[model samples]
Each structure stands twice: as structure tokens, then as C-alpha cells.
Target: MTEIELNNEYFEWMCQLVCNERYSRRLSYQKLLRHLHNIDFQYMLPMDGNRAEDGIDLRYRFGYEKEYEGSTIASYLDNSPCSVLEMLIALAFRCEEHIMTDPDIGNRMGQWFWNMIVSLGLGSMSDSRFDAAYTDDVISRFMNRKYKRNGEGGLFTVERCKYDMRTVEIWWQMNWYLDSIL
Candidate 1:
């Protein structure tokens, strides 16, 4: 496959791994996939690369099957632009898929995916409403630890948070979120 084709395949795979219809009321699966593709396209890692590594590690830690249509993270990152946001979003999907036990939510993982997007205030940035400036600003804030102590703009926002969600890792923040809703 050509470079563009390969990138498109990889993006579609990642979107499939993360997209869920039940939780996508604000944004459809197709729009979410396109948005993720855009986000990944614009993503540039920091000098240290710790954050990128962390997000990649999280995706792997979730044990997601990455051999999609003959593409892996190595191949995808080898060609396309690098970004943690999409990977982290995928990680959240996997985490909720495996960890959360909320039966009422039906598709728990899908709900968690949208919840995180909504938590970051990205739900309204649909295809028609997508503004790169707003998307970039929110993504930068998220990666740079600019979210509030209680995780106002982060993936998991806890009401009356006991721990500083920005300082806390995503795993623990997810746990906090599960606890909060339970």
C-alpha cells in the first residue's frame, strides 16, 4: 500500500478500536474517526518524547490487538505523524472495555470513550464544527498538564475530586472516575 493508503488504514483501525455508537451522541463514529485522524496528523511530540512513549505504552498495556489489516504501531508511527491523544483515547477505550463494570451503561467502553471526549469538551467539535484552533488548544492543554487540579479539562473529571487529576496518571484517573460514578 502507498503511504497515504497505509496511513488511512492505520487511522481507520485505530478509530475502529476506539469508536462506539452508544457513546457517540455528540459525535458520530465516522466524525470521531475523522477528528482523531486530524488530531493525529497535527500531533508533534515533545523534545523528551516521554509523553509519546507513555501513551504508546498505555495502548500496549491495554493489550489491544494491533495487527489490523497488516499494520502495527511501529508501521503506523514509522510513516504517519505521531500523537499521544489518539493513542490515549484508544487506551481509555480499552481501559473501560476491560476494567469498568457498569452494567447499566450497556457499552461501557464506548460510553467511557465519549465521556472522556466530552470531559475534554471536544464533543462539539464535530466535522462541520471542527476548528483546528480549538482542537489544538485543548490537545495542547491536555498534554501540557494545563487542566485544573480536579481534571476539569482532562479525560476524567471527578466532582469533588480528592486527588489532583492532572498530577495523577490516566490509569488512576480512570479508577477515580469509576469510583465517582459508582
Candidate 2:
């Protein structure tokens, strides 16, 4: 029996979270993940400090709850490239799946994830039309907080936001997004 590589396992897990039997777009997600991984290596050091915390949170999640390779996210990081954008996407998936559990809502897999991608103006980025330069531009805009005050280019867009999203952390932005949608 061939053993599955941990990085492959993790990527498959991430892919599964957003692409399931009910809603599957495995190839597109893989492309996006690859894109994020490649770009993340360059910006691993947080532009600000908040994303570092988000990366830590994601590391802990993979280490403790999931027990990927006996609770050591460092190994994963060393073995595979993961970015704050990827972590944020994973967190959003977890929130949509676990925290906001409302069966009545019929939340399909990748629903929230795609919502965020679209909100970031990255919905058009697909395997067929994948543009590395454009993707990098969008990611740079997000990391540099070039998004509008209302979060237009960021993960969440709250038109009537109480906080300036450009200056807010992603966690708060996600919260406001979840709040706004409801």
C-alpha cells in the first residue's frame, strides 16, 4: 500500500472542505491553492502583525484538533507552503461548516469560500484563465490593505461597516462579513 504524503493529504483535506459531492470543483480549487502557496512563500512574513496571528491559529488548528502528524504544524509548514490567504480561506470554511450550523440554510460546500473569492475580485481566476500577474496583483492589494474602507477588495465587503476594513484585521473582517450576510 502506498502511503499518502502529508502535504497531499492536507491539500486534499482543504479541497474537500470546499469541494464535496454536493459541490465539486476540484481542479479550479487546486489551481487556486497552488497559486496561493506559490505567492505565500514571498509574503510569509506578515505585512502587518495580524496575519501572523492568523497563521498561528491555523497552525494550531491543524496541529491540535486535526492531529496532523502528532500536532506539529511546523513540520507541515516546512514541508509545504501555506499562506495567510489559504489559512483565512480555511478558517472561513470552518466557520461556515461548524459555527454557523443551520441545516435550514442548506449551506453547500465551497459556498462561503467562493463568496470570499468573488468578494476579493478573484472569481474570474480559473484554471483556464489563470493569470499569475493578475492573481498577484489582487493578493498584493489584499495584503497591503489597498481594499476600500468598506472592504471592497478584501475578503468581506460591509457597505455599512462600523470599522474601516482597510485598517481592520481579517478576523474582524470575516466577522463583519458573516454578520452582514445574515
Candidate 3:
């Protein structure tokens, strides 16, 4: 998988935060994990009018219960390219079996990924659309965010992605609610 250049501190901190709250009920985190749980509820399929708050069973782990270790939001982000947009789209694509013809891939894993993408603001789940170029564009923006063009306009000053203090601080604030539970 191609990695997205990221402010590693922001991305890793988000990863670690998700990891820590894999069992907790952080709102945004849960918003991102709604579809990875049990099928007993059987709320509508992801592509069919699935909402962010839909499929969210707060008490349950996003994937299998603690009894069996399985996929979770933590694992999804870990496998991603570090761009939120790319990560959501990429993971959704990865879980899909029919990449070109369908978006849901007609399976539980696919549904979960699709729903999570919708919840996390990736795109419309109802639309059966996929774009490789858009994914590339998103990655480019993320890569460009870490560098500044030189006066020559031909070169860039490579500041690196991981050390972005602003992103790290934003993540810190976004996840501040977790501190109370931790």
C-alpha cells in the first residue's frame, strides 16, 4: 500500500488514541467504527441510507468482542496511508471484492468499511462511484501540506510530515475528552 505523507505525530497520536479508546465511547472514534460490530441488530446495509450514528453499538467493540481479536478502527487506520481521505477510501476499496462494479462489495466487511467511510466524511455511500485519481489528489494535498516551495520555485524545503506541531495539537484537543476516561 502506498503510504500518504503525514504529520506522523498527528497520525500516530490519532492511532494511539484510537487504540486506547478501542473499547471506550469517544464520539468521533465511534462515528468512525459504527459498522465493524455484530450483525444481530441488522440495521440497513451501509450503502442504503446509513447514518453516522447508525450501527453504532457503543457498548461493543467495533469488531469482534474481546473474546476474539479481529479488525477494528485502530487496525484500519494503522493500515492506511495516513491521509484521512485516502485512508477511508483505500480501506473501503481494500475490503471490496468487486472493485470496479460495486462499492459495497456485497459482504459484512465491505459494508462496515463503506459505512465507516460515510460516517467519517469520505463521500456518499449511496453513490456507487470510485475514483483512483481523486485518491491520488488527496494524497498529493497531504504531501504538499508538509513542504514549502523555494524562491527558485523549482525546489521545496522538506520540513517533513511527522513533525507538524499544529496537527498534533489539534488532535490533542480533538481527543481531549478521552483523558477523563483513561
Candidate 4:
């Protein structure tokens, strides 16, 4: 299949899994595993086999390992250029309230979201320095403090606080641009 087709399939699969009622609880990880099984996606059980615990799993089923080529979820998120934006859009849609309230993960998600835009060659909509500026702006807005320059000649400036909506707008516009393209 084409890359776009593959990405779309994966995206739909993830959306269905997340939206299922049985898989939508706080103890949802097990539900996710069960959903994966229902969809014929193999997964590795946690080495300890204690499904109640919270941590990474090391013992994956052969099918699951082979399908993903041993890449961790984070690595797949970082490298999958074609579907990264859609994945982020899905995540943002699902976690809208949490994103607005939790600055740390939201900022990181914003950065990754913008980075995906850059990787897709959509950087021309804004200045070349947009990503760094956008990240700094996000930090300042969420922390609710002004940034202070560390040194007169340094390229880096330190933010004393979190970020706000204006900072988020920069990244939002980028996402909007991407949606238009897609």
C-alpha cells in the first residue's frame, strides 16, 4: 500500500481503539491491549505479567515485534513523518481540556506537532526561526512569566515561567496550515 494509505489505516485503527467505551477508563491500558487483540494486532505482555502495574513492557509477542520492527512508540511518533500530524491532531482533539490545563506535556506535544510541520516542508508559511521562537513563547505563556536573556551574546534565552494562548497560537496556525494542505 501507499504511505498515505498505510497512515490512514493506522490512524483509523487508533481512533477506533481510543473511542471504544470499554477502553476509555482510567485503567485503560489493559483495555488497549484487549482492543489490540480484537483488531488482530499482537502485543507483548509485560515481563512481570502484572497488568495492573504501570511501566514499559519488554516481552512483546513475535508478531507485534516484527510488525513494528522493534521501534518504541515514541520513536515511531518521532520518525513517522507522513502520519505524525494526523496523530497529533487526533491526540489534541481527544485531550483538548487536559492540554489547556497541563502545560508541560502540552508544550512538548506542541513542539512535536510543529516539528512535524517542518518535516513536511511546510515551514515557508512562517519565518525560519519560528520553531525556536514558538517553543520559547509557549514556555513563557504557560509558566506565566517573562523570559530573561542569560547573556548579551547568547542565542538562547531562559523563560522564568509557563506559556499562554498567544504563544500557542503560533503553533496553532502552523497546524491549521497543515490541515489545509492535507
Candidate 5:
């Protein structure tokens, strides 16, 4: 099959997977093979440099590496009449709650999420000249501090708050702000 055809088949499979109701035993290798067989497509299992082990992981790997640079899943989803904001929120929840809890993986996930927001042209308000309007606020909330000047014109620092704060609280605040706008 041509690359485009493979991509379309993959996309359809992803949509089905996302919309599937059954979570338990839904993502097994057999299930994937069955789905592909039903679609008349044969899976060419990856040998090396695949980066991930499963269909979902492969899709995410493609997205993160910008293999689909000009054309993105977010843009496709945005064309729908339904709110794409929910999708973004779901992504945020996964990143912040599930992925970001790990000290090793948290920052990478956060950076990836931020990059996606920036790429979709959803980073800032329509009338604003800034790349993102609420980025500083979000960062401040995440760090649990007020923004302070560092004696530099554009450089600023966060002064840590006295009260102890949890990372989850900060994530929630960021998610809240994102939900309000998008």
C-alpha cells in the first residue's frame, strides 16, 4: 500500500480505538491484528527505530517527531463542529496526571504539550501580539509563586510561596485556565 493509504488506514483505526467503549482487553496485539485484517490491511511489524511498541505509541511518536509536520491531528479535529477543546483537555489530563507524575518523564511531557499548543496557533489570543498570553501566569501557578522582576527588562523570576503546594494543584489551575479559554 502507498504511504498515504497506510496513513488513512492508521487514522481510521485510531478513531475507532479512541471511540471504543471497551477499555479492558481492548488494546491487545490480537485485537490490533484483527482490526487491521478486517480493514484488508496487513501490519508490517517494526523491527528497529520504532520508538514504541504499540499502535497508539507509534502514532504519538509520529506526532512528537513532526513526521506529519504540516498536517496535524489537532488541525483535523479542529475542523469538526464539536469542540476540540475537550480533546485538548483530555490530552492535558493524560499528560499532567498520568505522564507528568514521573520525575524523569514529567518535564518532557510538559514541554511536548506546550509545543503542541504553540504549533496549533492556539497559544495566544487573536488580537494579542504575544505568542501566548497566559503562559507566564500558567508557569507562575505551576511553580506556586508570584512573578518578580529580575532587574532585567524582559527577564523575570518566580518567588516561591511560603505555603506548601502540590504539583497536582498547579496542573489543575493550568487546566482550568486552558478550559476557560479553549
Candidate 6:
């Protein structure tokens, strides 16, 4: 496929994630967050070296949340592929350049990432370690810290942020699967 076409596909996929809250709202909270954190999103670039929606509500309801409420951290980590979050990271890695160049796109990814963390649980909000994740000034700068709803308040300001792309290299290596897909 041509570069533009590939980029378009990538863009639309993300728009769905941002626009269609139904899927995101129903994500497996703990599983999604864990998966999101593990995939390095800082240096991954698209094969070709390749937008925002509305709210950032970090709420969830899904397979694990129901049957796995009492699941321990170990179990949650080993939770069978939640699919969505990891898929997102893979996409980010595939289209890193396209995503990084667009502040809106990067911010949305950051929004999605932060929302996933909040969706995990309110306890994560108060944890200092959450803030520690972006201690790297570059990673911290590309994210959005003012994404609260009209009056939702930034109770978890540190954790509720999203990436704005900026000029930083916030992506890691692309997923191996992208080799054939691209």
C-alpha cells in the first residue's frame, strides 16, 4: 500500500478509539493498563516513518473486571491478552512518525494512555510512582495535563494527562508483526 493510504488507515483506527467511547469504556481496566505500560511507546517508528475526539473518561467494564475483580497483581499481569491496549501500542509503534508529528494525535494517545491508568482504579491516581513514569522531561512535555471534563477536576492531574507529540522521540521500536503488515 502507498504511504498516504497506510497513514489514513492508521488515522481512522485511532479516531475510532477516540470517538467511539463504547469500546474504550468497556475495556478490561487492569489488563488494559498493564498492557499499555509494558509496550515501550517512546521510540517505535512507523514503517514509512509516518486527531482528537471528545472526553477522556477512564471508566471500564469487561471480561476481567467482572470475573477477575479479586485477581491478584500477578494474575492481572498474566491476564490473557486484553488485545485493545496492546493493539494500540503496536499501532503507535507502526505509525510513530505520523503520530509524533501531530500534536493532537500524540496528545490523544497520551490521553488514552492516562485514561487507561485511571480506569485501572482511583488508587493509582494517588500513587507517586504513576507520576514517575514520565520523569523523562521529553515524555512529560509531549503529554496533556489539562484534559479534564468540564467540571471533572484534575483530581489525578498527574495521571490524567495525554501526549501532545511536541518535538520529542516518544516512541520505541515497532512491533515485529508490523514488518509483514507494513
**lDDT against true structure, model 4:** 0.31
Which 10 residues in a row give candidate 2 its minimum summed lDDT?
41-50
Task: Show where candidate 1 strays beyond 4 Å.
Answer: 26-73, 76-82, 101-107
Candidate 1 residue-wise lDDT, 31-114, digit = tens: 545655456522223432443454455434332454443345455444434454555655555566668655785545556776
Angstrom error at residue 96, model 4: 12
User: Model 5, range 1-182, lDDT digits (tens) per residue?
Assistant: 44555456545543443323232123322232222222211112222111112223444444564455434544432233211222232354455555455566433333433333443333342232332334434433323333222111111211242222232232343333334333
Q: Estimate each model's TM-score.
A: 0.71, 0.74, 0.23, 0.21, 0.22, 0.21
**Of 1 and 5, which scores higher on TM-score?**
1
TM-score between model 4 and native: 0.21
Q: Could you give candidate 4's per-residue lDDT for residues 15-124 as a string of tens digits?
A: 44333344233322323222222221111323212221111221122215336544443343224222222333333332343333356644333333333333333333
Please list the Cα RMSD from the true structure of every candidate, rounded to 1 decimal place: 4.7, 4.1, 19.0, 16.9, 17.1, 18.6
Please list the C-alpha lDDT of all candidates, in the order they appear: 0.62, 0.65, 0.29, 0.31, 0.33, 0.31
The candidate scoring highest on lDDT is 2
How many clashes does each candidate structure show, in the order listed?
0, 0, 2, 12, 0, 20
Residue 140 in candidate 6 has what lDDT?
28
Per-residue lDDT of model 2, residues 16-103, tens digit only:
6666655445446567667775566223224434554454455455556566554345655444444745555555656666667678
How displaced is residue 120 in candidate 5, in Å? 29
Q: Determine which window of 10 residues in candidate 5 has minimal summed lDDT.
A: 149-158
- Cα-lDDT of candidate 1: 0.62
lDDT of 3 by residue, 1-182 (tens): 11233223334433332333332223243223222211122212333112222222211232333332333344432342223322333333333432323445433333434344332233332223434444344334332333222101101111232333223322231122123223
